[model samples]
Target: MNNYYILGLDIGSVNISAAIAKFSPDSDNLSISGIGRARTNGLKKGVVTNIEKASTSIRQAAKEAMKTAGCKPDRVVVSIAGAYTGSVKSQGIVSVPSGEISINEIKRAMQMAQDNAIIDKDQVILHVLPYEFKVDGQDHIEDPIGMSGSRLEVFTHVITAEGNSIRNLIKATNMAGLKIDNMVLAGYASALATLTKDEKELGVGLIDLGGATCDIVVHLGNSIVYNDTLPVGSTNITMDLSRALNTPLANAEEIKINYTKLLESGVSELQLPTMGEVSLTHEASMDIVTKVIYARIEETILLLLNKFENSGYLNKLGSGLVLTGGMSKLDDIRNLTSLMFDNIPVRIAKPRSVDGLFEVSEDAKNSCVVGLCLYGSGEFTRYEIDSNGELKYKDSHLKSMTSTKSVNSAPVIEKEKVEYKEDKSEDLIKISKISEKNAEDMHTFTKILNRLKQLF
Candidate 1:
């Protein structure tokens, strides 16, 4: 059984994570073979501050994962943070020379859309996601291939990132001895791992609150309509606590993760160490810590709310908000987010289930990495822009389905043929019995006629 292997790398400001997935085409099953994470100090928000340090971090994480999997992957799908990324909407139209839409025409339409989009000179297109298609004058067509049409058009969401930032990331990955197969938006990757089909169709909002950045994506209908990133994240809260309590940043991070309650109303006491001297400690009120954490979280949520409102998709979120990433583990985050968003439903989500994903699936922080693996396995949209920046139809799974049937159909057809022959044999037996009965009647008629002749 041939299997496909791919590694997913999520390079974050605070940490870098890598996961290996093995996908079996015969069974259509995806399984996680290994997972790795390492502390990183090379990135601030989404920008690579030090390529050497970032490359070291990536190498460590990938090495650990490869050790566990007992094999090294030739290529990887990596996540690009949303901080340095932006998207624009554009449309493309073309006259179909074949008078019908095919892969070539679809690719041309997507290329036209990319060419037509107005992008900054310092940025490059990462994805051209065509959400809606039109054939001739008809609109809202999802797939135009195999359909008769004189004209083909596509409406796309073009995701672009700063050229320098992208180059830096690619360089770091190359320095780590890894080749990148695809680069995905961090927010979209998290959404793919955590969101259900119903949530996506019903319109949902996803927020990936990591250490130094909060990435947001609004998925509506069949594709993401809007995405943005905020520089503030859970790290802001830790900084606030450190300043307010005169504690070390590491201690403040520990306190923020373990002590603060955002929605609690009770007061408590705590002991915190001073910034430079671990031996020097002082009493601090839990109320102060809670107040500081709440202030930062509220600010982050408010900023996100403003972005959502401006996106023109605020009212379209039927599935409300799904919160993920490391920050989502905070106590009562959902309650606070719900209240701030006017009581629209809210839930904290982790990565969806995959086979052999034991510990990693339990944390929301792994959503992006896991989703990257899924994307590598062709679990993303039906149509996607390839690494060459050209839109391609992903029909491998469909081809697998057809291949499976072709392999299995012969036996099934043969069984049906055998059953059909048995039925035919039963009909022949019934006909033979009827023939015998007819012969008996004929013989009885002849005897009656003979008896009548003798009487005469």
Candidate 2:
């Protein structure tokens, strides 16, 4: 039996988490094998600032996970976040040949979208998610193939990131002796772990409040329509507490994590420990702490709301907001978010349906890493470490099918020439019809022939 081991590595400003899982070819199920976590020092706002420190953290975390799982993994699917990531919605249109749309035509339309996207030279495309397809003048066509149409148009959300930031992250991971199989946006990964199919289909917003960055992704019409990251996150709250209370940074973090509460009923006074003291050695008015924390959190929420408004989808989120990340564990966060967003239904999201032994701390903070594992189990891409210790994409294959799968188990296979069978039970219709020539290779010729016949 062929078994594939996969790893998900999430490198954050405050912590690095690793999740290991195994995909058995016969069962197509990804079973949890092990997990590891370590404090990170080299990243600031999810970007690698010190390669050495980041590499050390990655190495330590992977080693610990390998030890726990009793199996070493060479490749990992990494999660990328920070302010450098950006996304834009673009559309592409192409004339269909023979009045029938095929998978090749869809690819061409997608390629046109990519070609038409105005991206900076210093940025790299991360993901291209199709929002909707249109045949002729009709809209909302999810599967345009096998449909009769003269023109096919596709709307896509293209994600891009700063080239330098991505390079730094890759270099650090390579230095740590781990090859990256693929990279996923942190917001999208978290949404995969926490969001339900109904929320995604009915339109929803996901806010991931990490230590140093807040990531947002909006889903509408069963696709991601908007994604962006803000520099402000829960760390700002700690900093405000530290500056206002004249406390050390470490002590401020402790208070923010342990003592700070979002009190909806508005408590008048509360007891907290003094600076440098472990016990409750001092009494501080709850109003003061409330002001400090609320100021920053409110600012963050307003910024996110402003972005959502600018995107023109603030009113369309029928499912409201889902919050996750390190700060989502804070007391009364759901209440605060609901109040700030005009009582829009708000809920704290955590990794669900996990099959492994996870610590209490892994509840909310480990969503990205666990989502990465889930993403890998559904995809069939291979990465290998080269002689120079750099991660290189080797090939793509069809991942084995499994019976027990979650809503997030959709395969993420890249565009490659691989044999696949038609499964009528699945949502995505597989292209099982093939000729002697590969679909990609014959696309242009087929289109030209059809055009010539029309001219004749």
How far does residue 417 in candidate 1 sit from its true spot (Å)?
60
Cα displacement (Å) at residue 60, model 1: 1.0
TM-score of each: 0.84, 0.78
Error of 1 at 282 (Å): 1.4
What candidate 1 gets wrong by more than 4 Å, as runs, is 260-267, 397-456
lDDT of 2 by residue, 1-456 (tens): 566677888888888988888767566566678888899979888888898899999998888888889997634778888477887677778888688887667767776665456665656667667778888889988667689989888888877777668767776776786766667888877887888888988899999899888889998864678998878878888888877776667767876786535365566654555666665455567667777877777788888878888878889889999999988877677887888789999988887666556552258888888788776665311221111112222222323222222222212222222333223222331111112223355578766754453332
Which candidate wins on lDDT?
A: 1
- Tens-place lDDT per residue, model 1, 92-162, is 78778767678888777776666567666666677778788888789878678899978887888887778
